[model samples]
Target: MAVIGAAVDSETKQVFDAIARSRSVTTSRLAGALITDFIRAEKGGQVVTTKAPGLPAMGHAAAHAGAKTEQVYVRLEPYYYDELGRLAAQRRWYRSAYLANLLYAHVDRLPVLCHDEVNAVRQVARQLADIGRNVNQIARKVNIDPDRADLSAFDFELVRMLLDVETAAVKDLVHANLRTWGATDVQ
Candidate 1:
């Protein structure tokens, strides 16, 4: 690694310090990233902007809900690393998060939803839960008094309609997720 140093005005130094503090990184690291971006831009490569780091835009699968405990490190060529950085930048994610998502989806064969898709799926899940509650109540009434159970009051058609809506929502969510992941066979 080579070291590059430059002197800046007091105001510029303050701004750099503030940005480094906001990003929870050292000033040197921030300077390195800025220099790398500048180099990339000058080389006609895509320049990644500094964005607030947060969780990746992938839906949380059941197995991924636990706290991350392990870490892995791999060495790659500069070109490969730059490409990975570009891909992650396109999704507004950290390179690590992007790689982890790819492993989860491809290696684990788990479905990952984007933010909007996750919300849609959650809505469908809530609807299904409401339907389940209603069915449970009716079942309880029937179980309590099998002789005088009134079935006419229950709106079977309404239940069917709700289920249909939920099902369609789920299907649409799946298709949208697949399409977002660049799956060509989305149906």
Candidate 2:
């Protein structure tokens, strides 16, 4: 197998990462599923675009009735922008419209979290934050009296307890977020 790399915007990467984390899968697996879906769709004649040496001479379709268009600006690497321009030109579409459609299509095809899952994730996040704050408080007290040999053992014990709590909390959060995937702990 060959490894391929691409530079994607942070927002896009984060979205994919979140999905992978939720599903307890690697990003590569998520990407493979998407590629497989695309290939299947193309083979079934759902995707009409073809790659050739020259640009495609197709035109963009008209907007649906009552559809409103929004204007937005995006910054991209020079090479990416150039590639988008070429692809847009091939389909006889304006660059902005082509990019908008591409983004919308990708988002539309992504897996969605249910309302309950969203709520659970939010609750786990709050628990994690509270655990972090508690750890910070313990560390601050320990830092202020590092030279106290008499209390050093006690402080170390407190720190170890806090570390254990924090680690368990993090693991709980990860499990809660990905419970729907029925994934076992690989750690």
Candidate 3:
């Protein structure tokens, strides 16, 4: 390989360095464009801004190798960290691999909920929990002594109606929240 030295401003150097690192564009092409721009400007003409040439076709492995990845740091509680370690061990994977998989599983294809949507969801969840508790209490009463309690079919119907109303309210609120947040297509 032949090397050529040229003086350029720091900003220009940064642009050239970025192009070279991309691996899709050559520094020689970038240098040619810069020189063209300089010639036009020297002639008292407007600076010509042209798009970079297309990249050469690359093999699958070359493309994969050229792709960039970044490292991310996260702080976790000790208990959570230990649990993650245990899960990784159970799966016979590195901690990073297990954690990445867990995150993808939980978040993949999920809609981005805003603060208001999240709060609405939490409220609906609390209401559902309350309804569940009430149903459980009714069940316990019936199961403990069915003969003593005069719980007729009407009582069960009333409970069912209450559940239906709560379920409908929760569904409507969630739908409205998602709509307001501009997430209409989410499942």
Candidate 4:
């Protein structure tokens, strides 16, 4: 970092940096020498420049792909409401809670959640090594009161919802383009 007092004006360099930061486009992320080209073209009223590159591309793709673009700091998911309603049915059910347990277990490596009162099931498949060892067993271990939960009472609707949820989960893994990041909330 030898700052051999250069002939170049430091003030102009700072202005260029500010402009770049405001636009959220770094030369490194850009394909070629776009910044130099842009400055050369800005002599007059050059309304729009090269392709609008930023965060809109990231969030739009994230919403469609069903994945968290970066750190998904959202406070729980919407499906949790549906799951909560399901718990108030003819008889309280733990299907959603079970699926969430599995999903978190697979991704976060946290022990499967065994709580009977919760929304969103784990929806992921079991990966135990024993003959019949399954996610249910893991769920049982984690449940506050497992022996009486009667997980054997399979609920078709819950299974279908979990499958649909898992399908969306897989889509989330697809990363989004950086160009769309900042512009996502504008509309």
Candidate number achieving the greatest TM-score relative to the actual structure: 1
| Global CA lDDT computed for model 1 | 0.69
Stretches > 4 Å off in candidate 1:
1-92, 99-110
* Cα misplacement distance, residue 116 of candidate 3 (Å): 2.7
Error of 2 at 93 (Å): 34
Clashing pairs in 2: none
Two-way lDDT contest, 1 vs 3, winner: 1
Task: Report residue 44 deviation for candidate 4 (angstroms).
Answer: 16
Number of backbone collisions per candidate, in order?
0, 0, 0, 19
Predicted candidate 3 versus true structure: per-residue lDDT over 1-187, tens digit per residue? 5555799999998866765545455677656666777898999977643433333222211233465555668789999989878867764667776655444333222233445546777877787788789878878987999887565643767767877887787677656544433445545
Alpha-carbon RMSD to native, per candidate:
18.7, 18.6, 21.7, 19.2
lDDT of 1 at 5: 96
Error of 1 at 88 (Å): 6.3
Candidate achieving the largest lDDT: 1
Tens-digit lDDT track of model 4 for 48-101: 333343512232223233444343332546697566556434234354544443
Winner by TM-score between candidate 2 and candidate 1: 1
Give the clashing residue pairs of candidate 1, or none.
Answer: none
User: Residue 174 CA error for candidate 3 (Å)?
Assistant: 3.4
* TM-scores for every candidate against the unseen true structure: 0.45, 0.28, 0.34, 0.20
